[model samples]
Target chain A: MELELESEGGELVVPVELLYGITEELTVTVVLPFRDPFENGRLGSVGLRAKWRFATRFSPGRADAVAAVGGITVPRSSADGPQAGPVIIAGLAAGRESRRWYYFAGVRTAIHLADEGNDPGEQLLLNVAWGVRPWLTEYLAPDLVLLVEASSRTEGRTRVNGQTVDASGGEVLSVAPAFLLSYRNVMLKGGVQIPVWEHLNDAGRSEDVRILAALELHW
Target chain B: MNRTLFVLLAGFAFGVTPAAAQDAQRDSTEQVAPAAHPDIVMRVDGLACPFCAHGLERKLDALEATETVEIRLNEGLVLLYLRDEHSVSDQALTKAVTDAGFVVRAIERHPPTEGTD
Candidate 1:
C-alpha cells in the first residue's frame, strides 16, 4: 500500500493505493481518494486499475515495454454533492528506460456514465515524458532524476437534463518539469504544471499553474 | 516555512554522511568477497529508477532462501546472498523479477570458494 497526496490549483487530493501482482506480466491497483481536507473535506471516487505488459524487448542495460491499461472509477458522494455516475477508463502506454535516460508516451480515455438526466461527458488525455539521471549510483545511496513532461487533455460536451452545457468541454495543453529523489524504499516526487495552450467552447476560467508533491514508501 | 522545509528535504536527499558511504562500500564488498560470493547474480532489464527498483528487492527478499539482496543500478545487476544450506531455483528467481515489473535477461550461479564453507 502507498499513500500519495496531490495538490492542483489549490485543491488537495489524497489517494491511498494498494497494488497486487497477479502474474509475471499483470498487476492491479485499487485507489481511494479524499479531497479538500483543509476545507470541506470529503471522500471522492474509488478507482481500480489494471496494467498488463504485453510486449517487451531487453538488452544489456536497456529495455522497452508496452502495456495495456484499463480502469474504472466508482462515483461517490462528497461534501458538495453526489457525482453523476461511474467512469470507465482505458489506455495504452509504452516506454523505454536505460541507466541514464528514459522516455515514455501514453494515451488514455475516460467515459463517464449518465445518471439522473446528467451526463458528464468523455475525456481524452495524452502524455509524453523524458527523464535523465545526472549521476549513476548503486543501491542504498540517494539518487536523483530530472524529467520533463508534455500533456494534452480534451473533453466532450456535457449535458444536464437534455441540455448541452456550452462551457462544459474544451482542450488544454501543458508542460511540467519534475524531479524524483529516492533512497532505499522511500521516494519524493514533485512538479509544477503550466498550461501553455487552451481552447474552450465558451467563456470559462482558464487553467492556472498547478503544483504537485508526493512522498511514497515501499515495504 | 514551506520553502525552508523543501530546502531541508532536498539537502537530505542529496547528502550522504561518511558512515553511510562506508556502509555502502562494505555492503558491496561483502557481496563480492571470495569467501562470501553471491550465490546468484541476475541481470534485470527496465530497472531505470532507484525508487521503482524497491519492488524488485522486496520480491527477491520474499524468497525463503534469500538472505541479502544488493543491486547495481548502472549494470542492472542483482546479487543474491542465500541462507546456509538453502537454495533458490532459476524459475523462482525469474518469476520474482517479473512480478516486480522487470525482465531477467541473464542469470549466473557462483559456488562458494574452497575452504570457505
Candidate 2:
C-alpha cells in the first residue's frame, strides 16, 4: 500500500498479496503481477514487513515505543530476462489512536539490486484512519483515510523493459485520500494517487489509481 | 344483560391486574466463570500501530487461540487465554508475532485464574 502508482514516465508496479500476515506485526507478503514489460505472466516477488502498534501504545499507560523493522524481498527471475535480486528495507515508525481515529507515520529506505545495477530508494509515508458512522460498523463500515507520501532518490539505477535505465528526475511527491470498509478482521481498502508536484524525467504523464484488499487473521 | 355486564367486568379486572411476576431470583456469582488461563503474555517490539495489531489479532483468532485476547498497548503485550492447553507453542506464538513485522521481546506463562496462586 505504500508503493506509488504513477511516476513521471514509466509504469508503476502492483502486487496482489497472499500469505499476507504470518506473524505479529509481521506479514508474509507474496505478490504475482505481470504487465506489458514483464511479458511473463508469472513474474513477481515475496516480501515481509514489521509494523508497530499505534493506537493502544498511546494511552496513559501503553507500550508504544517506535518500531524497528528489517525484511528481504526476492523476485521471481525468468530465463532470457533480467533478474531483480532481493530488496531490503530497514526503518523506524510510530503511531497513535483516538476514540474513532488512527494515525501512523514512518520513514524507510529500500536497497535493491538488479542485473542492471544497484538502486536505493527512500520514502516517507503517513496514514490516517477515521471511523465515520455506527452503521459502518456492521461487518463493513464505510470509512475514510488520508495519506501523504514523499520520496527522493539519492543514488540508484533503474531498468526499462528489462534494461539498464536512467534514474533521472529523482524526487517525487504525492498526496492521496482513500476510503476503507472494515468488517471484523476483513478490511477492504482502495484509493487514488494524485501527484501534488515532483521533479522527474516524464513527471506528469502517468497517474496511478490503486485498489487494495487485505484480510487479517489473528489468534 | 346482567350476565354480559359480569363477563365484561371480569375481563377488565383480569387485564388491569398484572400477572404474577416470576420470582426475582438473584443470579449467583458462581455461575459466572472467571477468566481462564495457562495463558500466554507476549510482548512484541514492532506493534507500533493499530492496524498492525488489529491484523495480528485477526490472524491469531483464526488460529483459535481466542477465548480471551487482551491487546494491551500500554505494556506492548498481547495476552491470549486459550480454551484448552493445546492452543500453540511458544515458538509458534513468537513466529506469528515476528512475521507481522514485530519482535517477540518476551513470552511468559500466566496462572489460569487471578490471585496469589
lDDT per residue as tens, model 2, A1-219: 222122213433444445543323344445444322333334446566555432323232223445666667776656214555677777666654332344555667777654345333333333333323222121112233344433333333465446555543255455555654433233344555555655555444333433332322222
Which residue ranges in model 2 land beyond 4 Å of their true spot? A1-40, A50-65, A79-84, A114-169, A202-219, B1-117
* Residue-wise C-alpha lDDT for candidate 1, range B1-117, written one tens digit per residue: 446545644554443434335445666766565345778888888777777687888799789988788888887899988887888888889888978878898888887332221
For candidate 2, give the lDDT of residue B37.
48
Candidate topping TM-score: 1
Residue B77 C-alpha lDDT in model 2: 70
- Per-residue lDDT of A49-109 in model 1, one digit per residue for the tens? 9999899887756778899999999888553265678899999999998778989999999
All candidates: DockQ:
0.42, 0.07
Regions of model 1 farther than 4 Å from truth: A80-82, B1-36, B112-117
